[model samples]
Target: MRRPPMISLFTGAMGLDLGFERVGFELRLTLDINKFVCETIRANRPDIPIICNDIRRVSTDDILRKAGLGVGGPVVITGGPPCQAYSTAGKRRSVNDTRPSRGGDLVFEFLRVIREAKPQFFVFENVTGLLSAAIRHISFYERMRKKEHEIPPDARLGTAFEKILEEFISTGYRVKWSVLNAADYGVPQARKRLFIVGSRDGVDIPFPPPPTHGRPDSLDVIMGRKKPWLTLKDAIWDLRNRRDLEYLPFPSWGKYLKYVPPGGSWVDIPRELQREAMGGAFYSQGGRRGFYRRLSWDKPSPTLVTSPTMKATCLCHPDQDRPLSVEEYARIQCFPDDWKFVGTTQEKYKMIGEAVPPPLAFAVAKCIMKAVKEDPGNPYSDPHLKFNF
Candidate 1:
């Protein structure tokens, strides 16, 4: 069983890389554009080479040099490109915005690195929004401004997944993709992400490891087949007495959060107060469940966002009126107790929030390792053998 080395790009906080490292994958090099995140990596994992440069400017040769490996070496590459463009919360701009070359477009750079590195296996992770977001020539507002008559069919282009699959297949890899929830892999948050695993050697591309924990009424849990999901209390109960844990000052929204009960949100606020707290969004349609929401000790947390104190998406502590502390954020992301973050409170929160949960990444890595080691032959050789998950 050969353990492959890994090159991690967009390595925010090194959370994903940490998971791989736990499962015996060697961390050879880490790349990230954020200097603060690079410092954080250096502050924690000093032995791994850190390349704090933009991925667009990085070449395959540069990465190979840093990793001390030759081309076509046995290696696994992992990264989650910026996902804001494809995020459902915002306007889905596939490729038209032209702001820093557009959102979701950075996956191209990820692919470029993969092709250049020519790794044996690779893992690509991102928010679920990547599945349906289509490449666009312009924003909807811009299209309205143009007053374009008879919009052509090509105006809306291939979906992000379609484009990604095309590229992966063209690169001579067998690809398998699935949407995985972090809580299912023992993370204390219900963070859902899309994972694409590809193998260059015709190996059966593996899916996520099976769920070890599930919601109370989930079929597996109901049948006594899996453990119940871990909760906020499970992840942060010990920190309750640890006053030294660093935290950002509660946002103004904390006032309204006081009215929110465990497992509650802005709706828990008095109607009159809701108007004052939520302002114009109070009248907006749809459930604004995230606003001033408090964590429920019994349930897995909502997806951890970049800012726990933001008015629109608060992660108020289960018992306290404040947002989750930076230490709590790291714990929920499955980062070890001694793993330190570098920067101001807000910067630290951003780094932790953007990270892939270490537990989930470990599960994915185990699947990849099994596939590469036990099933290196093409899936077509045994059509009955498929990714059951």
Candidate 2:
């Protein structure tokens, strides 16, 4: 069967598109605002048509023309819009974020194209924080007040997600969404993301795609059906001795990292030096596990951030004193060894960090293809399925 053409938005590094392509989906056009990301895409897949303009300025007509498609075309649309506004790691401003540079409202641009192009299928991806985001952000201090209950429903938890879903539903698509961990899908990271899959024809896509890998002691692994989760050692051990590896130097506070054991963090620092290492963060209540954190050979990595040198989200190498190298980042994200990334080292890191891991994307594409091919007479029928893990 000829697979439907795919038009990708926010196509950073083409990690997601690569996975779709591996599953036989032909990518027709890719779009993104970042110049470096566009260069990377071109450097790797020069044949693909790419739009480097911001999505807000790029009309649906332009997208359709570039993809060589018409209204209601049998095409699949996929994108992970700018997610910082909904990311827990950042200020959860939701739709209230108006910074043009940040593009917090770009999710609506995605919705606009979906409505205009009327693609047969669409996949929306974002950080897991989207599930709990409020349309109007309530600061932690405000929430601590005795009158917090007086806050309007629109300002309460999950309102932002509800509003997003309403917008998608209004476009006449049957949507099914779930939170999935990339490790469960065989990616060597414990990243969890939200995926919303929709069908214009009301065909329900079977979701929470079955796990291909599990914890070493999990039932599925014990039963000999699923493989054990891929580990940091499995992903980047070969690159350890490479002399040409590129990585950022640690910040001054990272001097304390030497005392941190593999898989440990600031908590492992000597009691006398812990306060000096963490500074004000030492008084912070949360686990603060990312501080001076070192990857463990036996475990999957923590989610890759834009930079490994940040004080709060360090991605230090297990045995080495330095951060994970650029090559190691690509490996953990399942980018092929030959994949060419454009721009400076930091640009490459940002692109790789923001990408959906290819292995996880491949798993999703496989399930989506299965749904597209199967008879729709008896669909999965569940309108919403949330995975527990």
Candidate 3:
């Protein structure tokens, strides 16, 4: 059977596109705002049409024209917008910041294009924080001074998710979303992301299958139902022996990383050393587990950030006393060893960190392919099929 064609937006580094391609999806056109990312995509896949401009400047008409598709086509749209607005690790700005339009905000841009292109299926990927991000109105700030802190019923948690789902449902799509762990789906990292899958034909694609791997002592692994999660050693141990691979210098915090054994973090520092290593953060209340953290050869890596060497979310090597290298970052994200990324060290890290892990995307692509192949007319067989997010 012929695979579906896809029009990709926010196609950073083409990590998501690569996974879909692996499952036989044909990518028609790719769009992204970052010049460097676009360059990387072009360098790798020269034949694919690319639109390297702000998504706001491009119209649905432009996307269709470039993709050589009409209003109705077997196209699957996929992308993760700038996630800081919905990331719990960040300030959780929600809709407070301005974008192209209230309608053109990147999340809504995904919807707008879907409405205009009217594709048969669309997949939305984002940080899990979208599940609870409140959609605070501008007036909520002014009212904050007069009232005690509390979420208004209408503006409570999960409002952002509800609003997104409602828009898709109203536009004649059946949708379901799930939080997936990359480690479970064969990636050698513990990153978790939110995936929303929709079909204009109301064919409910079940959430990707149960995890295939986990911790050795985890119930499934011990019970013989699944394999243990991939370890950091599994992903990058070969690089440790290679003399040709370039590595980043040990961070200024290297001295502290040397003291953090595998599977350990800031808490392992002596009380006096903690003050010297973490400064004011040593006294902070919460367990800042990411601080001075070193990867364990026996476990999957932590979710990567754009910068691995930062003091807050230090991804120190297990025994090397340095940050993971750019090549290691690409490997963890499942990019081929030879896939070239074009940019400065930090820029390269940004591209790698922002990507959807290829194997995780592959699992999702496989699920969608199965549903499409079965041609389940009403895939949402359950009445309670909508995600409760």
**Winning candidate number (TM-score):** 2
Query: Considering only N, C-alpha and C atoms within 3 Å, which residue pairs clash in candidate 1?
Result: none
lDDT of 3 by residue, 316-364 (tens): 8777777888899999888998898988888899899999988888888
Query: Considering lDDT, which of the candidate structures 2 and 3 is the better prediction for this target?
Result: 2
RMSD in Å for candidate 1, one decimal?
A: 4.1
| Candidate 2: 10-residue stretch with minimal lDDT | 378-387
Model 1 lowest lDDT segment of ten: 378-387
Clashing pairs in 2: none
Q: Against the true structure, what is each candidate's TM-score?
A: 0.89, 0.94, 0.89
lDDT string for model 2 (1-389, tens) is: 45668899999999899999987788999999999999999999999999999898888998999888888764589999978888888567888886765556888989999999998789889998888889998886686673757887878988899999899888889888889999999899999999999988876677769888999999889999899999999999988899899888997877898999999988899999999999999998884878898989999999999989998989999999999989999999999999999989999899999999998898888777666656343233223433332
Tens digits of per-residue lDDT for model 1 on 274-323?
A: 89999888888774777788889988888988888777888888888788
Best by lDDT: 2
Which order, best to worst by lDDT? 2, 1, 3
Off by over 4 Å in 1: 97-103, 137-158, 375-389
